[model samples]
Target: MRLENQIAIVTGSGGAGGIGEAIARRFVSEGAKVVVCDIDEEKAQAVAGALGPNATPWACDVSRSDQVEAMVAGVVPMFGRLDILVNNVGFTVPGFLRDLGDEAWHHVLNGCLSSTFYGIRAALKPMREQKSGSIINISSAAGIGGAPGLGAYGAAKAGVVSLTQTAAVENFKSGVRVNCVLPNAATKSLTAWFDATESGRKTRAAIEAYSRCGSPEEIAAAVLFLASDDSAYVNGTVLPVDGGLSSRVACIDATIE
Candidate 1:
């Protein structure tokens, strides 16, 4: 068991078919005790119940630093130690920059970027004391390369990549590793966009042309690899589990026309 006897926390894991839930299940299957943290109490409880003895539910609004800190503090006492943290709580309101509101920008940054910052800051205390821990942050291919309608989201996710690198360098001497995964999966957000907009359709087609779209489980595999000792030498890296979608140049030749 790669994570045997380890204790892990996965935020935003309450959604029925989301990546966070998948990661929690995968960790439990690998013999790790998981804390399913979500803003929705009922949903978090439901997922934790389904995972049986290996999981516990914690209601937390991760964007709130106080709540995040409390969650981390509580977990260490309950589990005796914290071995892993997956900052998976994030969402985006897709819109062009000109059409996006100030509130929308704040929402994206708070949910996607600020929440991750809070999680990492809270986890660092326990992790540094243990002198051995792994933190896996979820980023996006949109972050690596700009997306037309997802500018705010892409920007926030890009911040995640920067934070991951900085945190890795800061904690490496303490035996803690920080890395991030840029996943291109058919998530609820993507599916909703695809159903509502023509641009979404084009984006999906382009992604599929580059590489077949993936599932939450496939993304979970990459997270697990980083969370385990198998990736001891890996840190401060942005691993794109995007089925090669992020490896190509999507721009057209300006001189062709």
Candidate 2:
């Protein structure tokens, strides 16, 4: 058990099919007590129940700083100590930059970027006191570059990447390894986006061409590696688990004079 005797909190893990749920299962299987949190109370409880007593469900809107702080405080009382914090909550609003409305832009940013900030801020105090911990922020390939029609989401994820780097540097001497994971996983969110409209389908098809859709388990494995001693030397890195797609750059060069 890589995470034996560790206590982890994973955000946005209440749904039936999502990255959060996968992370919960993976952490539990590796002997970690996980707190599965989501905005939907019922869904959170259901997922926790299915995972057994070791997994507790909590409802929280991470975008709110007070709620986020309280969530961490509550977890410490129940779990004794927090060893890992996984900022897995995220959302996306698909549309061209000009076509995107203000509400949608804020919605995506709050859910994806702001929530990550709140979670990390709340966890930092405890981790710093303990002087040892790991924080994993889930980013996206769109964050590494620019993705048309996903401006809001892409921007938010990019913020997460930058946050990870900054936090890692600040917390380096404290033994708190802050890292980010850019996963290419097949989940409800991605599936719905891919099936939304004709244009969405085409975009998704192009994405699938370079690599087969990765499973949630695959992503869980990466998170586990970051959270464990395997990555003790790794810090402030944005790992792209995109199956080589992000590195696939085409070249057109001339060798003739």
Using lDDT, give the best candidate's number: 1
Cα lDDT tens digits, model 1, 1-257, are: 99999999999998878999999999999999999999999999999999999999999999899999999999999999999999999889979999999999999999999999999999999999989999999999888997888989999999999999999998878999999999986577666776588877876777676677788999999999999999999999999998887887767425564
> Model 2, 1-257: lDDT tens per residue?
89998999999889778888999989999999999999999999999999998899999998888999999999987777899999999878889999999999999999999999998898999899898899999999889888788899999999999999999998979989999999874576776767898876986787776676677888888999999889999999999987877787635434598
| Candidate 2 local distance difference test against the native | 0.89
lDDT of each: 0.92, 0.89
Q: Candidate 2: where are CA atoms >4 Å away?
A: 192-196, 250-257
Compute the lDDT for candidate 1: 0.92
**Which segments of candidate 1 are over 4 A away from where they belong?**
192-196, 252-257
The C-alpha RMSD of each candidate to the native structure, in angstroms, is 2.5, 2.5
Please give the range of 10 consecutive residues that has the lowest summed lDDT in model 2. 246-255
The residue pairs found clashing in candidate 1 are none
Q: Against the true structure, what is each candidate's TM-score?
A: 0.95, 0.94
